[model samples]
Target: MSTAQPPEDRNTLEDSLDALPELSYSMELVQKVQGGEGGAMDELLERYQPRMRRIIAIKMGAKLRRQIDVEDILQEVFLIAFRKIEGLELRSKASILRWMAKIAQNVMHSKVDYFSAQKRSAGKEVSLHGLAPSSDSLEPQISAGVTSPSQRAARSELQELVDRQVERLEPADYREVILLRDYQECEWDEIGSLLERPTVAATQGLYRRAHLKLRKQMRKHLEHPE
Candidate 1:
């Protein structure tokens, strides 16, 4: 006959798993990386690398500033974030996103500062900031380029008009706001968690405003198309 497992052992195992929360587990994984978990550390970096790259793309306006090499910024952001992520207080994924945003902002600022210093050293105003991408900044950012007849005709055209307006957003900052709210059908609370906003209502309003702007822009695109 086998001996019965102790209740306390089962509870302890559950608690350990619970520490890795499903809601915003990415944030917890980052925390674990700070605590020196090898697997968690690697996963965290891999997961956000693409996102970090996209943020860099928008910040440098890669299309216009062909020389910016957004990857440079991604490296810088990761190095800094790896250092400071532990200090951040993330109650949800929204909070985690805001933390990531802060890191991106700081990385861009430092790049600006470095370039400005270089310009001063050379006695010229030729700083290394990139120009913004065009309204058609497709490819990796706007177009995952999913092909289907369903998205090929009028609907595609209509959606492309809306997409242009989205690119005009605060340089890759609010992509989650659009993707989650409209594309993924995420609820307002989930959005608020990612954005660090105070309430679900606030997130809803943010999405509502975006939708209104998209509609206005879509009408204009259809009217012109030139």
Candidate 2:
């Protein structure tokens, strides 16, 4: 009887364990934080911080970037999320990131306002126009797993260059489409809803036109840099 009856018992135990319900990684953290578990908020922030950082960096542009550190913007985003997390439905993992991206965009806008006010006080001209986003023509081919400091510096430089050209996109809707499609990773349906387009096809058409216009601008930059 040296544990000879154990195989069936182990199989039953494994089956029972497998049958237990499991929450998604995001949902689990969200639940814990909402339930007021210690450290849950920090864990949630840590998990989502990287993506938010990238969004802030990509959207802040050269002017806002000069006046505000990316980390500061990210911190504000996380603070807003933490305060409002309990009320957020966070229906899905994608929802969590989408919510954060929206918050980050808002934070960027606020910072821009503050900076513009300062410029106005100094009697400097402030322009509300923004260029379009990444171009299909000259977008940088950043290799995967290139996370060294030098590579990050190179990527940031290229991104800033692209961003500078985007500021020249005519009509604000073009910029909004690029930010929604590329940075926010929104579905066509969601983007259409936000953009007030009647259909997904219409939303896509707008994005295509915006992309082509941005590409032309980027091409000009590559061809002639002053």
Candidate 3:
């Protein structure tokens, strides 16, 4: 009556799950969405929405948050993403979110431009949480001090692996902290401010724990890649 899978069969199933491709920006997902696969776009958007919302919040800041709801901005951002999904280029596993972030920046800038024009005409000044309408580049895409693998192929593999593992970080804030500090290149204080960490030390502590968890997962995957 046990009816459980045999040990060998269970091992195979676990390996399959371990090897399951990164959910959101996988080549298969992109192709599915571009090829008009039903529900593909929905799945893709669902996977990336939380990260996208944080990006919008940082870009919009507290000042802009009062003027426009983040959800409203997210609607426009996703609308544009849906319309333009075909043009998405996946240079690396990180590419999809990068492309989406650019779209978000453009959308936020356009709204800021409208507000800036209104303020100028009214002889009032407008500020977007200390960001100007012309501000570009959501922090620099610098290395988070991770050593690159020597071989180009290995490097690319490692980068994709890192991207996948970062997406898998848990407790939401852990993912957000790594994203804000490493991916978005936010300063410690800025990360604290955006995440409401109360202090730079708090943000750093979260980043360390998140980074450790990510590294442990990455090592397990690399050691037993399936």
Candidate 4:
């Protein structure tokens, strides 16, 4: 019997295997802002604000989606960018977006850790007999024999590894494609717009190439594991 992988594992495997396109409007805005032109930062923010919010919302995950406020995180991300933009060396438009995404990812991870700790502490006060089996308890069964905690840790590590590899990819377009499609989970249309592709099909082809490269990198990582 063939056993299905857990959703997280499947998505991680599929998504990890994933471009920037030509310089467009955002690139010009990034150049202007980097050059310290007046009102350029505001224009850049205006252009990317929606994209940033979408990225934060998607990365927040389902567990924290209801509990955490995306707007607050979005504001904090932009605020940090505002304060630190001068010091940052943004080589391309993709670099700026990726930098912002990293900040959002860090903030979201910290929040998840905080809430998880709170839940763990509260769990300890409850009677073991009174507690019901959680999704955690059923993880192995749901994962087709893989333990949840360990699998989750491995998945997280793999994602981090893939992200680092993506940074080293040649042609900034490939890096941007992975960041937007895989990391942020944006739709092809949106990705196409950002990448300045004429159609979703063009963007899809770009993503496929990027994914193949990422898969090769992952294979190498597994083989070496250093």
Candidate 5:
């Protein structure tokens, strides 16, 4: 008689299998790019531009978004990506996408820093820390349950660990759920369209499952770190 494997064991087996990278269209273009085919680079830019734009828009705060154009930021990101592409060790299509996303985030952060400095220099800076929290405000507090700087740092590190695990998730769809829903903050409908799901409900379900899986993985990692 065959006995059923536990969920965790089954998941581990599946993840091990899925960890092997397969050659995809994006990977093919990356190879062409490495071979000095300039057209491949343009094709990659065209393929990923929309998604990169959405990520930039979502990550750019309201203050920066008002002062700078998203398209300009995107252009800068693409240029940086192009220059750095030669140095990248392309592991998979997801790795390429993640590399571009990291570039976009860095560009957005630089813009935010520039504008913030300008505001300070102009004497127009506002201090939100002096004001009381509003009922509708979603800003998290460092003192609610957190007491020390180390605790805050630990929380931040934990968040980063979770994000890394999400990026490393097998079956690219699972990774897309976290990227779209949590990182990009895309609407359920938009996620459905991007993922080609039948409906918003389906996208929501995918996000929920992916989130739970991530949480489980984090817990296991914390309990038994390698």
Candidate 6:
């Protein structure tokens, strides 16, 4: 007469469920919100809010903190999502989170377009030739005014410079590996998830290729001394 299931029964159930393809939880929450569930909306907010904050913080932390807060962006995204969510056609049940993320892209794109249009109207050329992204050399001994404290400072600056240079890599895969190894500083195994490759292959091939390109660019930059 005991109601409790045996451990074997529970294990079998869990194993069966785990056998199916796993899906992202965000999509589930978004669908729930779309169904007019108040609690689901709140749950979506709670779940995505932290990720939104971290992404914005990492991208724009040095900007004017007084002008914008990440929470404000989250609010804006929520409002925008509400207005546009009805129009979205579900590509797949799994794509709900991706669709909402596209909304975020549009929000950011619209703001950027507005500001850029305004800047152009003022007759200002935003692009300064030679001021665009350029790589730098890390030849410590070759540069002057770089010894002891100054050398350490120069080394730090060079590291930052190399990081910035990595952002300019062309082709999606090349840039991705560089970002994984340099900016986000994620492990090869973690990077593989983003790249959809084996960890050993990602490290040996993509990582190595990216690093070689970086080294060549750095040497060239030092030679030019710009």
Decide which is better by lDDT, 2 or 3.
2
CA lDDT for candidate 3: 0.60
lDDT of each: 0.51, 0.61, 0.60, 0.58, 0.58, 0.46
Candidate 2: give the clashing pairs.
130-167, 131-166, 131-167, 131-168, 131-169, 132-166
Tens-digit lDDT track of model 3 for 22-132: 634567878998999847887777666655665566556556766777788887988898999999977654567667777887988878778888999999978754321
Arranged by TM-score with the best first, the candidates are 2, 1, 3, 5, 4, 6
| TM-score per candidate, chains pooled | 0.53, 0.67, 0.50, 0.44, 0.49, 0.42
**Model 4 lDDT, residue 26, Cα:** 63
In model 6, state the lDDT of residue 5.
23
Best candidate per TM-score, number? 2
223: Cα error in model 5, Å: 42
The sequence of per-residue lDDT tens digits that candidate 2 reaches over residues 162-222 is: 5555455666677766656554456777778888999877887887777677777777777
**Model 3, residue 163: what's the lDDT?**
51
The clash count for each model shown is 4, 6, 0, 8, 0, 0
RMSD to true structure for each model, in Å: 13.8, 14.8, 17.5, 16.6, 18.0, 16.4
Candidate 1 is scored at a TM of 0.53
lDDT per residue (tens digit) for residues 1-226 in model 5 = 0022223333432221112123487778877887888789888776666446544654553345567777888889889988888876765345665677778767776666666688799987733221111100111342246557786565545444544455446456776766755444445665688788998777777766766676677678879985
| Per-residue lDDT over 1-226 for candidate 6, one digit per residue giving the tens place of the 0 to 100 score | 1122222322321221111112356566657767876576666555444333333322322221223454555568777766666565544422433444445545554444554576699985333211111112232332234468766565546444554444444444665665444433345665677678865564547765655565566667668867
User: lDDT by residue for model 1 over 1-226, one digit each (tens)?
Assistant: 0022222222221221111113466767876877878578566765555444444454455433344556666667777777776687766444544566567667666666666677689896544334222112222222234455554443334444444445455423254466444333345776677677798667766665555554455456568875
Query: Would you list the clashing residue pairs of candidate 1?
Result: 93-194, 94-193, 94-194, 94-195
lDDT of candidate 3 at residue 2, scale 0 to 100 = 11
